[model samples]
Target: MFIESFLILLALNFLSAGGVNRPEERIVGGGPIEIEQAPWQVSFQIRGHHICGGSIYNADTIITAAHCFFLSGAWQDPRHYEIRAGSKSIKSNGILVKVAAVKVHEYYVHKENQFFVLQNDIAVVRLSERLQFTNKVQPIPLAESNPEPGTMSFATGWGNMYGADAGDANKIPIHLQGVKLRIQSPNFCVRFHGQSKICAGDSKHTICTHDSGGPLVINRQLVGVTSGRGPNCDRPATFSSVPYHREWILNAVKSFPQHV
Candidate 1:
């Protein structure tokens, strides 16, 4: 009986491991959007699979979450990544650009516990080649200041659409998706996530796994980078504030090899 119990436990562990490696899907409560509507959205992919969302910073720079490239206590190689831009769907209609370099914030940290903690969750990605600008592909302007509480914002990504209680067999959406979110009070956000983050969303429209590094925009200006959510994905999502780290982003872009 003990042997049988051990075998069952081992089987369960294997299944849990497999689940962790599965590619997550779209934003919870969001609807499909056209690429032209969010021309700066890009799919951050490893090999040929979509993993996270990013925004175009320029013809050659992409901004995303630092955690996207750091996992299991190690940073991922830049050569293994590519960006899919100018397309609404990850499966088709986009230009895939190779990665030249990735610059994660020096202070970024990942802590695991009952609730995961991510700090300074921002990164700059340099593309191997300059992207040709079109109506369906353009750079977004970074926010210069924080938006007041109750300001309406939008977040876009190809992340999981359901909460943790939902079954994993749900079909993954192929197109880009977006949700409307409201900025929360700065005091409330800083209480839990410190001052470098912004809090937004409601129980009904929170972001989920795979949305990391996606853009949170107010009036077409990039305001936040999707950071994380609560354990059940039912709380307001947290994002790395762009205005808080704008200087770092500018410096990272400038430091990249100009010829690349």
Candidate 2:
């Protein structure tokens, strides 16, 4: 829950983008990243196509943005999605795990007044089987405590870079990319994302289309989940505050019966 002292607004344009900026590409003003740089990073896919990015929360669970399914009008049935981990390429080699269940925040609902705002944009995905942990496949710890404003962090993903053809599957990046970003003040985020969300980077350096559901990490801890981006992938991007939903995540994972 957000502190009572804070209040907010919706940068309607950002939410109305309608999942166009998924796999929001490479960190703007950043360069190509190594395949194993962020081992916990995973690609959320439909069939064999990459739709969004997510973080490996544990051996059999993934944490990603809820809007990844809702905003894109994707089927929520576990059979319709897959997790490709331990690799950067969308089509080549990796451990492809079938999804068993997708637990979206119960309170996460889309509002339809003027802005189609999807609040509480987080979800937990349970894999059908436990994943093999390796140098290239591992889980990242969620941030136990929130970091201060202006803290440096990195966001890595295989989304579109430079907004080229943005949502075009053919134009999305195959190799992952990473860029350095700085956490923004709550006030800065309120201008674009509203409460319970945070902003990272600035006009010159920000996450873009196709990168939603990716992790924003600081000190190797998962701090944020990529939520939405400004139009054209430029300007500051909003993310679901990981620390804010930590308790819900723990309970969600604990309630799921382990699968063999």
Candidate 3:
């Protein structure tokens, strides 16, 4: 009986932490959105499974959180990843393209103790082939300036619909989802995530686990990349500020010019 109980507990832990159907890929308090509405969104998958969210930077490039490529304290190979674009569903629909290269920010860091810590959590992904642009497959422009606190922003992803404490953390949605979040002041964001992150969200709406590497847009401009969140889904979420790293992003894209 004791052994059986122990086995059950172990299985539950694994399901909660690593199960693909688990709540890790959620946009809490969000609703289904059409692919044409957020055409720049993409799914950063590993071995055909949606692991993180990203945004289409151009026909052959994607921008996502660097931590998406980090697993078990190590960086995964770029070859193991692919980008699914022009779709609203993770299970079906979209153009799957091979990943040619992944470039993480030079200052990015990943540390683990009781909890994981990520810094400078941004990355750029080069695609193996150029994407054919359509109304449902377009690029979003990077924000030239950060939005002031109280500005409204939008976040999209295919993560969990409920918080971890809600006893339904495994409720993974089938279609893409989005929510409106209010940008918090730099002082408020820095207090929790430091200066390198942009803070946004509220008690009613926020990003969740699989939402990492997703885009946070204001006025249709990419202002942030989803990075982290508080203990609950209702709390504010943090992102890598696009404006703060705009130069690096531009240079990175330039260094990897598209082939004719």
TM-score of each predicted structure versus truth: 0.87, 0.85, 0.86
Better of 2 and 3 by lDDT: 3
Q: Write the per-residue lDDT of candidate 1 for residues 32-59, one digit (tens) a residue.
A: 9999989999998764566678999999
Model 3, residue 255: C-alpha shift (Å) = 1.4
Q: Per-residue CA lDDT of candidate 2, range 139-255, in tens?
A: 999987766888988998876676634535554678888889888876674245544777788877788766778999998899999876655667677788888889999999998
Backbone clashes in model 2? 13
The order by descending TM-score is: 1, 3, 2
Runs in model 2 deviating more than 4 A are 1-26, 71-75, 112-116, 164-171, 190-195
What's the distance in Å from true for residue 202, model 3?
Answer: 1.5
The reply for model 1, stretches above 4 Å from the true place, is 1-26, 164-171, 187-191
Q: What is the lDDT for 210 in model 3? A: 74
